[model samples]
Target: MIARRKVLLGGAGLLALGTGSCAGRRMWLDREPKLPLGIDAQGRALWSNWSGLEHAYPASRAAPASEAELAMLLPKAQAPIRPVGAGHSFTALVPTQGTLLSLDRLEGVVSHQVITATVRAGTKLSALGPALAAAGQEMVCLPDINKQTLAGALSTGTHGTGKGITAIHGTVTALRLVLPDGSIAECSRDERPELFHAARVGLGSFGVLSEVTLQNRPLSRVKKVVRLVDTDWVLGQWPALASQHRNAEFLVLPFTGKSALITHDVTDEPVRPRGPDTDSQTLMDLKRLRDLFEFTPGLRRRAAQMAMKNLPEEVAVDEGWKLLSNERPDRFKEMEYHLPIEHQVEVLREVIARIERDAHGVFFPIEARIIAPDDAWLSPFYQRESGSVAVHAWYKEDHQWMFKLIEPLFREAGGRPHWGKLHSLCASDLAALYPMFKEANAVRRSVDPAGRMVNPFVAKIFG
Candidate 1:
């Protein structure tokens, strides 16, 4: 069966080689956004997010090497003191004309107990995996993309798929925060419990996180599997699929009737490293399909269906941390919402229908994952198991259609928007979704009376 599937995939690749080259020129002519320059007028450098959607020319950029230095700079620094990670967020979270703070200097493992590790907030997840492995431990879960800093991921409630595994902040036992007033506070369930819950997924609005203590476990190996299946069939099996695997998620290819089902399970097998990623090549192929047949949905769907049939499943065996995350090089703007687990399939079906009917220019696959609920006050998954659905648009494409067609469906299903993604919700809309909205705001005001850390974007959400 594997040999036959490989032959079919090889044939499809040869066909794509001939057709894509002929049509590549048209794809390039589709009004891609020009890359911005590094420096701006007045000699200040321009800072842009990974997606090139949000940018700013800050008056000052500071990278503090120690927690004491960060605390000293916070109170006296200019207003709108925004903290930046890898600039991976698509929202306006990091843009600031005042002060831009980077904690990259104060990074890495600080200390470790029996089953816990104290890591600096600036540590990136990509580096944290191997660092933790060296100590014979690993995190409970990690997001699909590992380029984000630990602080950035926790601030936004980033998560991975698993029935019992919660978001990254769910594993955090304690944290040290530098308030806008330059005072340092250590918070946990025992001391300052309100601050602990509210600041767990604080969106960098409460304060800048300095160090976090995570409750991790001994490192283990896992087997990763990837297969293509019919979208409708997989939707029917999603509940069972999620329950059966240790980690499971799926990507729905819009216009086409197929989906990619990926699963990771604990195993004692020998290590077999993941092969060179074909995700980028597959993405461009889908874009070529859109470019060639945007006006004709039937032809586009038929072509995609034919190309994906009988594709061999990809298999890999490695440490859980290594296989759970991936390298995402294609830049795009995204919006994701977490809804009640029962409402996921129904809402997803409607989103696909609308995208195919109204928005024909979109070619990026829709990602769906499951996350267990946690106690963090501002977390989107607070107190309810959730199924998250994310939609993406190539950086150059207009994403206004998401607000019109996709967002309403998610909102109608009692969904909460991701903090780091694009959304049009104001304070009132958010208050209706999160039960602890008022309490979280109260905590923020207590810590930042002058609103030194509040930017225009954050003000709109927290007001």
Candidate 2:
């Protein structure tokens, strides 16, 4: 029996099929169920991924593991079949009406070579990090948040603030994708290359991403240094930093006149070190308090400026994974765009001007990053060397105005929006941005002809 009744938060008792302690059960007798057919697991006003500002309550959610298990459940996939990982996305890309695919059971190292591993689709990045470091390796790069699932992060091309490297997908040499028909495939640069391109950043339109074969290198120690710099001077020095550092970027505090410059690089070969994060709570609290202040309207910006001006200088060194990831306690709405790498400073100048002139009501820091182009069809940096700029606001604030102010600025500069980050582009805009947009859709059609893997957003963008 896969069904068991448990008391929910309120007086209500909800029955979660296929996920109780007895998930180990085989076939159960078909029988009428008392609980409503459509509901989420744990049922706490759930949304897909952590792009907290975008979605609220999904119609339903599902957590499945194993190829045969996911195949058995395809017939019941949600209308949008949006797969979610740790809710890390900033967009409604995983918005769903029927089912939400959770890959929690499909976790841990499935198979491994000395350097590489074949990972399950539903694995969380936090789970992946410690495991690899124990084996004397670490993920090449990671976004600020590490809670996202591997499949979901790569699906939307989540990135870090690296200089020459693309996002996590850049290191993927192979993929094990599940077609809508439940057939599993393993694709790589040398074999089934076309499928590899299409699936690398598939946006969950092709099928469930069952597993990924990643290209990993030997893990080595790294040094992370964070310094305070004037925004003007940082921009002035962009050229030199761009050339010298493997990972270099700056975090700008709006109207604060200060920025946090960060650089991470490899050191002479040594095992990475780990220790307590003395500043962990302080950092988390700082982010959380900023979001709290953002709700008070006119007071938020003033407070943000004061807070930034008073911040003390900080610098640290730690394991590559430990220092690269942050414990994100604040939740906000966000939109990020990839523009030409050379225009990074100029675009930022214009954006800053708009914020100052139009009284743009955003308090979160503006993040600038660089990415070398890749062959992934849906990749934001496809065929273009690019610099990405991300903007955010507290979730409680009115975001439509924020989106309106930034969308045109991005378009005028030939910007491409991050698939997982917030943006307001339709199919036509995306079609113009990538030549392979059509080809990617073609591959999806071939793999999921009936559109079983699609949701409304996926349909609207690619149909």
lDDT of 1: 0.88
Residue 62 lDDT in model 1?
Answer: 95
Summarize candidate 1's per-residue lDDT along 79-172 as a digit string, tens digits: 8999999888888988999999987887999998777999999999999999999898988589989999999999999899999989999999
Best by lDDT: 1
Least well predicted 10-residue stretch by lDDT in candidate 2: 1-10
| Model 2 clashing residue pairs (backbone) | 49-87, 50-87, 50-88, 51-89, 78-99, 80-455
Number of backbone-clashing residue pairs for each candidate, in the order shown: 0, 6
Q: After superposition, how far is residue 15 of candidate 1 from its true place, in Å?
A: 5.9
